[model samples]
Target chain A: MRNMIVASTSTLYGGGYLEYLTPFLSKRLKAASIKELLFIPFARPGGISHDDYTSKVRAVFQTMHVNVKGIHEFEDPIKAIQDAQGIFTGGGNTFQLIKMLHDLQLVEPLRKVIYQGVFYLGTSAGSNICGLNIRTTNDMPVVQPSSFKATGALAYNINPHYQDPIEGDQHMGETREQRINEFHIYNHIPVIGLREGSFIDVQGTTEILKGTLKARLFQAGKAPMEIEPETDFATLNLNH
Target chain B: MRNMIVASTSTLYGGGYLEYLTPFLSKRLKAASIKELLFIPFARPGGISHDDYTSKVRAVFQTMHVNVKGIHEFEDPIKAIQDAQGIFTGGGNTFQLIKMLHDLQLVEPLRKVIYQGVFYLGTSAGSNICGLNIRTTNDMPVVQPSSFKATGALAYNINPHYQDPIEGDQHMGETREQRINEFHIYNHIPVIGLREGSFIDVQGTTEILKGTLKARLFQAGKAPMEIEPETDFATLNLNH
Candidate 1:
């Protein structure tokens, strides 16, 4: 069995950090019977320190009466994951997060625990790791990971914080759609473009698209399709 | 002597591919006594085939009476670079271009030829490879190269297609500036955010910022500075 909430971003437009997610998150945590949550702040957004980033998350979870601790504080992080009732991976730089995950050799262990039914939550870069690989991440390559392989908790790759092309914008950088199209040229993996405020709620084999925004689904050699909210992601053939 | 024209993009606003660059390109080629240009089409913009992409560039250069040949057409790409009088590496995907360069072991040969004053021109992804590493590139990681290590023809990295933050836009994706800042957190290599229409012209040790736009200079632990057009980039201490 698998249980996870993979969100496109920690904060939605005009909302505070974790504010928009709290209601949905509380419901998930409550159903999972998780009180204490272990936080992985390895992504280190804006280069924030581990303790500082952890405190930010702690402050948010505190409102729900949940105890939060960063994984870095633990002497044995592997044991921390093994013992945790719930886990949250905050967003930041995907390269750094995957680099640390590989360097600590925690990918397999984390994958095993999550597949065995541990409660897990991931946002942005955190959500990216839940995919088969980190190839579709939108973050800068601040550092190099040992391997692009990720947790693979989900069958497809996740393109978190996916944005539609801005109308009338003169900037020549490839649009998000163009970039994903190029990705298909080299890879056949199905990619789910999770816009901000959108998420995938996976329980057992049922993965539903949660949140109000629509998600864009891209497959190799096929036109991109818009996936509506409340759509069951499992219904789609994601495994290529 | 080293002679190179590294540009932020191949196309400018409302212009055909290489249209804005043709005037400058023709002058440079004439000065270098070049009749034919060798093209590297591995980047393959929009997933165009190498022959098709090469043909596009060939058609453009043909207007100036300069014959063009793709390196892929040669059985010995290494020898083609060694013998070419002028070389042009067009833009597309940085990862794909660097991957091909590494796979064919052409990085060192290309560097040697450019250093030997072969009159090289690079746009977008092509310009990115002239740096110390591809770490600062704005392109998506559609594919991973064996190493981030690039040609190192330039001491610093290039952030091609650099754009400033959009005013009043609510998109949460990190702006190009913020992305570069994140890059500085893990890297000490200096980055030149070459805006569209801007380029760096390198002759021997002197590198000048050309075109009508200003470039942004980014270094670790320092605020990004706006570099004016016509500024001699070589005067700046970019090694830090």
Candidate 2:
């Protein structure tokens, strides 16, 4: 049985880091009897040091009486994932995270433990690794990874922090929708545009859309459709 | 001698496609005595077909009595670049364009022609390839290319369509400046953030910043600086 919390953003507007998801996240940790979380800080938000990033998460999880440790501290990262009670990959740069994961040869080990049910939690760049491939990420290519292949924990790709076109904005850059649409030109995988504060609560084979915001779903050769909150993604034919 | 016009965008606010650039573009073609232009439509903005994208450019250039032909129309694309009097590459998806260019092994041929004094023009994704690499691109990682290396025609990378943080915006996604700073974390290469309406005129050994807006210069471990219009980029000690 797989258990996952794939979030669009770690922190919401006017909220502290992970403040909005604290209640639900605390409940999940307690339900799973998880006391310690192995945090993957490879994404390195703002290029903060591993210890600094880990401490940030530690401060939040400490409120729930759960200890947080960064994987970088472990001698054998593969063993750390294999032994962790729960895992949380914080968001930053997807390219940087993927590059390190691939360089350390942790993708396979991480995938194995997740399938065995290690309680995976990911936000932004973290959530991106759960997809079939990171071909839908909105992050810049800050670095080159060995490949775009992700953990494949989920069958589809995730577009986190997905924003709609700004009404009457003068910018010439492509909108989030247009970028995802361009992805469809070369890839056939389904993509879910998770707006800020939105997430997917995955338990076993059932995946439910959480939060108040609606998600946009784009499939190959089909017009994007809006998915309401509380909708079970597992019910949809995502294989297309 | 290299003669090229690398623009941040093809169209500007409240302007038609290439309308803002038409006057300057017309003068350049006439000065070069270029009657026929070779167009590279591989960027495929909005996923438009090559023929359709080429037609759009053709419609505008026809006003100047200049003929435009897509490289795809030629049997030997390498030879097409080698024989063209002038070339224009429209913007779309940088990764897709790089993938095709690499897949077809046209990078060398394109570079050879450009260094040989073939008048070249590029916009958005097109202009991105003229840099040292495509790592600074704002485009989504919709596809995985064999490599992030580009034409290396320019000494530094270009962050096209560079925009400042929207004042008081609620979006949690990284702003263009933050994104570029993150890029500097993993890369030592200098990056020039070209704002909309800006173009870098590369004539011989000098690259001058054109247009009304100021470009942002980012170097490793240094605060980003503002570059005014008509500033020569070659004068900057970018090696630092």
Candidate 3:
């Protein structure tokens, strides 16, 4: 089956962008395993141009002189994705990313690419779309949607950069945990609270956590559990 | 004129259980000369019975020997609200509060009470429904509704407990401001980021800021502004 490596952030710079799959990306690229990198730039900040937003990936690929293309430029993106060697979706607004994907009917094709084991890598919004719904998202409902459904890549939703409630403040706002719990009241999907500098590496069905802190797993009506790196997440039995 | 005070917290205790409403609710209740406090227990935590929730509120009121009534038992809540000396809404799940209000057709009646100068008080979810839409709420979209509209009590939306993004996290989640900004793009309503310990005191035609920090205002296609507590919120034209 096609493998998916979903990260909270890109691990290129000192930025603790959830340093997952750096070794994998490097090894895969060095061995000439993938002929090209198809960059999905829909999550670009403020929906900027693909060239401007995908520059970081382009720069990284330039070091290896690997072929790269931003699928946003294509008039027929579904076919473009179908013909791609591998896919990497950068982070930005998940709502915008999903909006564009649904608008262009690329969700199914992208899903097919992942299921085909065509080397799929996702960051932030990219990672969020891999889940059942954007309910775990820290993003605001900036736009209305036909639905909150996503790719259903995982049984649990993803809350990237999950932070506990601040210790001392008078704000009456609900904490991230509280918000996610509310999401559970109406949703059966479990949630994965991925902090900064953490990620999930899925190689053929095996998910390896990579980061300093353990990821928090939240199932409906159950207390969250912290899982360290090397923990096999697939065995969580999140479906129950 | 109906005096509406959307508090940040309850004033029953030392105000530590809830911390945001010191100035807003405390000052308004004092000014309204409200010795009697009628509590609305529909948003009780743990889904407690209306009688149980009401008894707890009455118990709390007994300490001060202040008259307290649970509006949940009233067949004509609107009439009860119209005749009440003061109505105080404690906070819980905003979805629950909204659902009950809509089911009971009390939104407009509550609005009417506020207009009648009944000295209305609310915290968290209670204050959230006071806006035109709960889009600015910190609550998760636990369930979808036919619409995202609310009471339209204020000219703008309220994002209580606004916090700045962490300085050093590689997590790719959107910040609180970014989320509300997204809401602005999809909806035209102005959003006010009311930090903890901050609130607006609505007395008759005057809505004054009564808190320690400046409230962040977000509008579509415009830069957000942080208005201080002393700013004349009533005079600010938000017609656009």
Cα misplacement distance, residue B28 of candidate 2 (Å): 1.1
A84-154 in candidate 3: lDDT tens per residue?
88888888767677878888888888887778777778887888988877767766545555566788776
- Interface C-alpha root-mean-square deviation, candidates in order: 0.8, 0.7, 4.0
Ranking by lDDT: 2, 1, 3
With candidate 1 superimposed using the best TM-score fit, by how many Å does residue B233's alpha carbon deviate from the native? 0.8
The runs of at least 3 residues in candidate 3 whose Cα sits more than 4 Å from the true structure, single-residue gaps closed, are: A11-21, A29-32, A46-51, A64-68, A103-105, A164-172, B9-14, B17-89, B93-119, B164-174, B178-188, B219-224
True-contact fraction in model 2 equals 0.93
Worst 10 residues of 3 chain A by lDDT: A11-20
Tens-place lDDT digits, model 2, residues A105-169:
99989888888988999999999999988888888899999999999999899999999999999
Q: Which stretches of candidate 1 lie over 4 Å from their true place?
A: none
Whole-model alpha-carbon lDDT for candidate 2: 0.93
Looking at model 2, residue B26 earns an lDDT score of 92
| For every candidate, C-alpha RMSD to the true structure in Å | 1.1, 1.1, 4.2
- What is the C-alpha lDDT profile of model 3 across B1-240, one tens digit per residue? 748766554532335443444434455666777777778876654445678877866765554445788887777887787788888777766656676777777788887778777887777677887888776766665554444567777777777667777688543556787787667655788877776666677877787777677888887888988798877677888644
Clashes of each: 0, 0, 7
- Which model is ahead, 1 or 3, in terms of DockQ? 1
